[model samples]
Target chain A: MTIDKKLNGTSLVIALEGRLDTMTSPQLEEELKTSLEGITDLTFDFEKLEYISSAGLRVLLYAQKVMNKQGSMKVIHASEPVLDVFDVTGFVDILTIE
Target chain B: MMTLTVKAHISNLSMVQDALGEWLDSIGCPMKTSLQLQMAVEELFVNVASYAYGEEEGDLTLSYEYEEELSLVRITFRDQGMPFNPAECLEQEEESTRLHVEDRGVGGLGILMVYKTADQVHYSYRDGWNILILEKKL
Candidate 1:
């Protein structure tokens, strides 16, 4: 997946494209790990993301846990497939999505 | 109905998903059903690829079938690497939900999605093959 990062004040926006699965989740994890410093609001733009698998969800879960300690996180513009995955896994209850 | 055998590796995930996705699409599977199937397929296949062989490579056979009478789609995954039952793991994950979010690890969520999304799930070991059968209503 292609991850585009944009920093604005204390909010950070990361836009993702392509598929997020086992092969690509580590990339996102590293990206979030290094970029989350001093940020209080994290937003994920999934408008271009094709789909997400459980591995991808795992990364998000970890990111959420990390963000929980420092700030807040939200996912926006998720594709239908991604949203369905979130729904099936009950991530809708755990993660803030728009 | 179709059966496909591929190397049990993470890199082959999209290839399997694409093949199954096309077939499901051709059969006019609903978007919701197809998405759920895709999720379960990835989780189960990834599990096999990651843990079944224990640092060795193996082959996994996936058989896809649709029962018109029941309007159900079934996918059976078979591998000879190890006799692992995902249903048992799912049971453990169900009970682990009591743990706090901070204490929760991300490992078992995949199998949990398999159990949540698949309408019927069965695990069996026969002929040295670990077979997992997952079905969803169309």
Candidate 2:
């Protein structure tokens, strides 16, 4: 998957494209590591994200945990397949989605 | 005999997800089937890492073999972290207040998804490992 990052004041928006499987999860994690600092609000645009693996969910969970400390996090426009993955994993309750 | 093994750190989950799909694709499984298999892998691995290992570190071995006649991908997950098989546990239904959200969806969904996706699944604790085997016809 490809990830692009944008900053809106303290809010950080990340747009994801392609698939988030085991191989591409690291790129996302790296992006989060490099970009999350100094950003208090985070929004993930998953409209272009086609597929999600449990590993991807785990990363999301981790990002949520991090955001809990510094700022707020949200996921927007998740694709059907990726949404299904989150639904099955009970992330709907844990995450803030729009 | 063929074997592929990789040592993974539990803290990096997203990378593992990407690796799973690429692995299936490399084995010549169609994209659709690969997606299903990868989903199952994701659920099981995350469950193990989260529930079984907790905050500890352990080894995870993912092995697969293709049975051309059956057109199948037989994959197994072996880990020494804990003795638990999520498939054997019954799922908790969603509950609602008037009938609430809890009764709609709660626990056991992941294992159920794994069951639905795999053509065959089995679980056993043998040789100091929690082993889960799943087969998907390609």
Candidate 3:
């Protein structure tokens, strides 16, 4: 997966492209860990993201836990199929989607 | 019925998906059903690759039979690794009510997705192999 980042003040927006499954989730975890410092708001753009597995959900859950203490987080532009997964996994209730 | 066998590893996930996609397309499976099938397959394949044999390398065979009469598809996964039953996890989650967000974990969600997406899921240990079968209606 390719992650493109845009830093606007204290808010950080990261857009992901490609599949976010077991093979690629670790890359996202590392990116979030290193880039989250001094950031209050985190937004994920999933318009280009085609797939996500449980491994990816784990990373997003961990990120949400961290962001809860810092500020806020939102996931936007999730495709119908990806959103279906979130809905089935009950992540739709836990995460803010816009 | 058709079958495909491959080494259990995270790196081979793409190949597995590609092959399954082609087979499903050839069968003229609906796009929605195909998506669910792919999701269920990925979850089981990743589970076996990550934990079934640990450091040891093994192969997993996936076989499926599509019954046009019933409009149902049955996919079976076989591996010669540890005997781990996924159905028990589903039972435990169902009995445990009032699970809070703090209790929401990512570990069991994959198996849960497999159970939810598939119409039926069964696990058995037979002839030194762990066999998991998932059935979905088209």
Chain A fold similarity by TM-score, each prediction: 0.96, 0.95, 0.98
Error of 3 at A45 (Å): 1.6
Off by over 4 Å in 2: A1-16, A20-47, A53-98, B6-8, B12-19, B93-108
Report the interface RMSD that candidate 1 achieves against the true structure, in angstroms: 2.3
> TM-score for each prediction?
0.90, 0.60, 0.90
- Candidate 2 positional error at B102, Å: 6.9
DockQ metric, candidate 1: 0.54
Writing each residue's lDDT as its tens digit, candidate 3 over B22-133 gives 8888888987778778888999999999999999999999997889899889999999999999887776644332355567665557887788789999899998999999
Q: Mind giving the per-residue lDDT tens digits that candidate 1 earns over B1-138?
A: 999999999899889999999989988899778877887899899999999999999999999999989998999999999889887787677655555667667767788888888889999999999999999989
- Which tens-of-lDDT digit does each residue in B62-125 have in candidate 2? 7878888888888888888779866556343122112223233223455766876788898999
Global lDDT scores for all candidate models: 0.87, 0.73, 0.87
The stretch of ten residues in a row with the least summed lDDT in candidate 1 chain B is B94-103
Query: What is the lDDT for B79 in model 3?
Result: 99
Best by DockQ: 1
Show where candidate 3 strays beyond 4 Å: B92-99, B103-106
Worst 10 residues of 2 chain A by lDDT: A81-90
Instruction: Report the poorest 10 consecutive residues by lDDT, candidate 1 chain A.
Output: A84-93
What is the lDDT for B129 in model 1?
Answer: 92
Error of model 2, residue A62, in angstroms = 14
TM-score of 2: 0.60
